[model samples]
Target: MSESITVAGVSVDTRHWIGGRRVASAGTFTDHSPIDGSAVGEIARGGPDEAEAAVGAARDAFPGWAATPRAERARILHAVADGVEKRTEELAIVETTDNGALLRSHRRGVMPRVAHNFRFFADWLLRLDHEDFETRGHTNHVSWDPAGPCVLITPWNAPLMLATWKVAPALAAGNTVVLKPAEWSPLTASLLADIAAEAGLPAGVLNVVQGYGSEIGDALTSHPDVRRISFTGSVPTARRIAASAAANLTPLSLELGGKSPLLVFADADLDLAVDLAVEQYDNAGQVCLAATRLLVEEPVVEEFTRRFTEKASALRQGDPRDEGTDIGPTIHPRQLEKIDGFVQRALAAGARAVIGGHRKDGQYYAPTLLTDVAQDSEIVQEEVFGPVLTLQTFTGEDEAVRLADDTRFGLAATVATGDRERAERVTARLVAGTVWVNCFFVRDLQAPFGGSRQSGVGREGGTWSFDFYCDLKNTVTAPEGWDQDHG
Candidate 1:
């Protein structure tokens, strides 16, 4: 039986969704909201056994689902999208409470994107192309085939959104999925399974196991039956999961940590540059693609810094449920400590805190900006994964591109320049999966999205997504009218 769990006054069934039903684990964990550390839900604490059950269920359902028509699969996904849209308000509130993001942002943007992920992939599946080439009197045909049970290990920052990013593609390809959402924010994931079932998704088609990565990551990834593993999280964790998947030779698509840069040039609109800089603090700076490092041209550094400081300082930080609040508390107490530690160490090493550099209130770290940071310093070199930005001055396009590409992580980057030619020139030199010239987070479903190096292993979006979730096959046919019986 499932138990009702309440977060931000939104109640959801918080039990593990396994084999099309809610199931409990041998133990339970109290999920707390970052707002005030109040217990929001008692959730299932899964272990190796739960992982095994979920994997087995998915394997059992794979053949039947794979044989189903793509149109039918699209239909079910759309229905799930409908369910997601209908419950957007409830889902957004729960996600805000569970993940510690602004309720307004989730309600207006994040949850809507969640529904769009499913709808886009659903219709895109119908447009999947097949190739038929005639060569040397023989016909060669190429098509995509669904891989078996996929293990989707999603991160906590954008729990439901990122999970659906992989889930939609995998399910659309007719592969069953076993999703393991991060333990930190799992309430919404449970609610997702409920929506899928209500939308008439077949039993065993979608399953979720709730547990710490240490307990279930290996068990899920190393399973011989698991064909694919898509993970989005830390570099260290990706290493561990990669090791486990290696034993089974399972294919992995890893979207790891990022330390992206936002380059501001002299020709850039100073007002727009400052606004985009402040926008990095969205989601309390937990965004992986946020331009944490601000590389500015020496000509306009002072004015840009002043405008950014004013806008950021005015940002309302409070309860996520409030419409006026721009940001909420960090997802956990330890996370707050980790964020402060990064700032404190950088300050000790001579980095100047422009406006904020410390805690504001309970679990709330202020929107922070640092100047006077060295290029090779730890603060600029690593992924802090907090609402902290570092500024460093450069002279020209070459230096700016050099600074942007300095980090090992390159998930995304932004170049704010008024010159069209300069935008193209610098963006090409900067090594990132996605780069925006004047805008920040302009996403298109058809574009390839991933990192150049340690940021991620494979791309996700459109055909790139299908490429990973499916296996491309070529079948060669004999010449027309050539029959063995006649011979």
Candidate 2:
């Protein structure tokens, strides 16, 4: 039997997934498409009461899920990966419609990686090794155990993929989850719940609560039963979540936004640099790790800026569903306004716009390129998080390193240079969680992923993710007591 339900003339589910069922919500809220401002659907407006029930469900399911053998858990995770792969197109379309990501990018880049994340963690479970130590007269055994009920809050941009990043590892580590998807982009998460259930996730093992952060974020974060939390979003919201999680002394992993820098040296590969610079316009540049600050050597600054501006101007913005659309609408009207405001304020402060400096159509902002931006200007210091790129120049390696590390954010950076020594020296001094050498956004699931400083507080990838989602316990036993079945 199908639990498919529709609301507000949109064929979408508006229910919370609780206890392996699509549980009804106390209220509902409408979500509109950023592409055209049409009501995409109504989402369950989950609040404190709903959050409590979901946490209760997760808490009840935790012991059983944790007790399941590692092989069994691994099997279920593999099933989830299969399910995601089977419905790749469907998932891609839902994400595009709900979050305004280009259809091609979701289908080719994000959706495939969603399935890959699950598979990677499944494989990880099989290869997991615990810590062991030998003492003079005793043996110490250390193992990672599942934390109790957990709350995973995902941001609007790349909701499904980001949710998978937390959910896969948490489940692989044996933690039951209560996921709270951002209100502005809850449809794909609703679909994700369906897929997980269809993949044979046990009842109460995974739950979804869709609603405004203001109404339900605190409830989910501060819930007594939630032992761990992993959140991805703005710094302000992260601060609030940190405060709420502290009330119960719950553990938290926050992956906040970044004003990342991409540095290009005079001896760098200009072609590759231009290619990466143009990628700042990807997803309408609504990426936390997007290289918004372009710090180029003074000698090549003019050529790089001209080439980058031409590339930015060539990016076409239209319906996100279009196969050829290079740039799409931002998440919502407010974000579009915010992007324009950043450019306007920068222009007022003496920054000159080389290309697009305004909105193209309804909910669509033109791909913008700016130069002569001051180092201390808001545009450079703050994350624009839109299809806007600002250019700055540095005289040498010292100035480039100083300019790159000038912001409070230390999430990710890209260093493009032909010299291996230059890449090594520059990347070493760069204060970021992840640095790409001669490339950009090339993700490896096995590597540690997260940020430093104000960008984030914890890592989320491979072993780091397992460590965060599980609690390590040590048991020491005397050699005499360990004589049991020994030779």
Candidate 3:
């Protein structure tokens, strides 16, 4: 039961999950394992033609699916949750193998988070209110309507979890979706489609098109029939999508890249701070919220680095599927090269490599830390998206906030200080959308998640996502004695 499932009974080619069936297309793309650089699977590389088909499918199903009651949609989503629960182990295995994340994290952390997203949005559907009111001597009411067919583009890092964030809410809001998963990690997306189909979702409500970004992604974003576009990936890509959506003025929500930071004050708990530093770099620091820059107060810089390096050095890095592995290889060989270049550039600019500064095999890069990195260096200026963290020290709260805010990205940040007043003050000054006080990556289902500046344009998660996927329509009713003709 854990074997690879094929589309159209063909092997060695790309496949698409459309209308509850695994259908193969003429175009194909190769998918590789980041750890060993071996071919794991192939996905049907869709192009303009396939994009049209997928969009058409979603459009065809839109009216009926959007007309379905919220309660019925909730039942379908709950069934998806149940189906995911049934194949939890298999999904986890495929996810780890395909995405190069630790198996334990996928099974315990990400999987549960996906389930929680579904359940949370399911409940949100029941609680949504289209309330009536009186305003200016006139009866008024508000209604929320689905934006019809949505084009959802998910990234590779947390494919299923991120997809769930979009899919759950969009479905709950009564929208049909055409999901274009990142080509690098299509296994879990395919598997997720299977699970949803098994859960008895109506045909054409959800479709997965696997392909390169240029082909399928471009077509989907610019498609005339798509009412909205929801994307989670790089800022550059998000910008491109925005421009494309502008062609038709289609509504869009983007959760793009991040160059997040962590600030540790002199009075903070050094051990806890060190733990968080390591945790931020978990999964090779590929996360959008990873604290790539550690700004420590001058007095505690030495001790913090000592503890942080000790913890970073102890992280077990090897096969992602291994139960004992804490970190895994970068998701692609090109990603490793890019990270290496950043480290090399930082080193050339007079930064010191505190722990790891090299690469191994095809895509395996050790958990790395850098010290004395110049504020203007590429490592600090751009998002590394690897297992690398740069260290810098600040003399005071003002300087710390200045250094943290001195970036194009304002995604997430962490401040560790025992002084409540100081923490509040620093949090206010930090430009990031999500600021963690003395903690990192601890997210709640109900919390609004997104970033400021170049990090992203709109928010995901919370009730806000429902608002993002749907449009607001206000209605006004005349009083019983009101006469339109006389007026």
Candidate 4:
């Protein structure tokens, strides 16, 4: 059910899928399941040479692939969606084993979204439009052209879903891709790449290279031949990748970090608000858009805190694969320790822990909730990337907007209020790219998804992804005798 692969016949160790083949290589790294801290398998450790080969394969495939009719490309995407559907169970198992995501979440949430992205982009390909402009005497046309050989760098948090957001559109727009999966969760990436090959994608159109970011990611980001780069990761890494991409002036799209806020008004559906807030922090707060900060109106702060803390305390934390577990371990031991330190520092700075805080082991930390944290504290200001929520109270709507916009990251914000006017006003003022009213984490494939400010640049999902993967060109022309006619 689980295996590695080698693309382009470059044999390597671990379970690496490369160029439509399963590869075993000498250099490998052990992959552990965060659920129980057990070894799942080893992943091939690709180096510069392998990365170059993968990129080269993409380059070689770009001309023919991009020349294919758009309808044909859409057919391929439809087939990909079908393959993913057929393997939903297998993919879900690998996803949970690799990243500690809940099996139900993968089956019910991630997979459906991934399939939707493919289907949505497939429709976009069929209806792609070009604009015609009539100058005084000549006709000008604007066309979107595929950027050749895209380098897709996906994160470990939601590997398959995030990769599909990029891969679906890039392929739909006729660009070949070389994907570098996060070193922490390479299994699903490898598996998905193999599935794409099996879905009848021509050799070299999609390639997966496995290794650490410093080695494989850096090589892919800086490679001169890679025409575009789409990356999803931390803000610092986004900056570095942007700098490297500057060498050739290659186009880049980034989906970086966030410290999103969830504002609860006095009139909000309190029960619903509390439930959504707790669910947002379910994945140990490893999600980029997790509502880690709760800004409640002063009048209802006490009641909201009571309900929120009670729900937070009731959350079950343990092995990710267990049916009863509501929260799982952090992706890595280092992340666990880092989150623990952040909570400790908040406590030292006069914050009150209303619920879980301490770590059970090196990998698992309780779903933590802290109140009375200073606005400037690291726990509130920086992205903890853990399941830690800090509560703050504001006096009025204006103050709520100000406090929510205070952060450097503007990825997402949620407002819980039944008043339509107030919701609209608060939503408009929030600096985040995505604003949710009375709901949280609900995304449609047809909607543009990305962040503002330090959260990220450019966008993904919907038609926006197709625009990001392609370049626009304008052509002005006349009839065969138009030059003389114009003169």
- Top of the candidates by lDDT: 1
Residue ranges of candidate 3 with Cα displaced over 4 Å: 1-14, 481-487
TM-score of 4: 0.94
Instruction: List runs of model 2 lying over 4 Å from the truth.
Output: 1-11, 482-487
Error of 3 at 301 (Å): 0.6
TM-scores, in order shown? 0.98, 0.96, 0.95, 0.94
- Assess each prediction's global lDDT (C-alpha) against the native: 0.91, 0.88, 0.85, 0.84
Task: Supply the TM-score for candidate 3.
Answer: 0.95
- The digit string of per-residue lDDT tens for model 4 on 1-487 reads 2344332232223555555565555577777878777776667787787888888889999999999999888988898898889878778777887788887788888888888778889898888777687888678987778889999999999999999889999999999999888888887777677678877899889988888888778888899999999999998889889998999999988989899999999999999989988987777789999999999999888888889888888888777767788888889877787899999988888999888878886488888889988888889899999889989999889999999999899999999998999988889889988999988888877788889999999887766887889887789987456455564
Error of 2 at 403 (Å): 0.5
Candidate 1 regions with alpha-carbon error over 4 angstroms: 484-487
lDDT of 2 by residue, 28-60 (tens): 887888878988655678788888989999999
Candidate 3 lDDT by residue in tens digits, 87-177: 7777777777778888898888888888777788989988987668888768777777998999999999998999998999998888999
Instruction: Report the Cα lDDT for candidate 1.
Output: 0.91
Q: Where is the poorest 10-residue window by lDDT in model 3?
A: 1-10
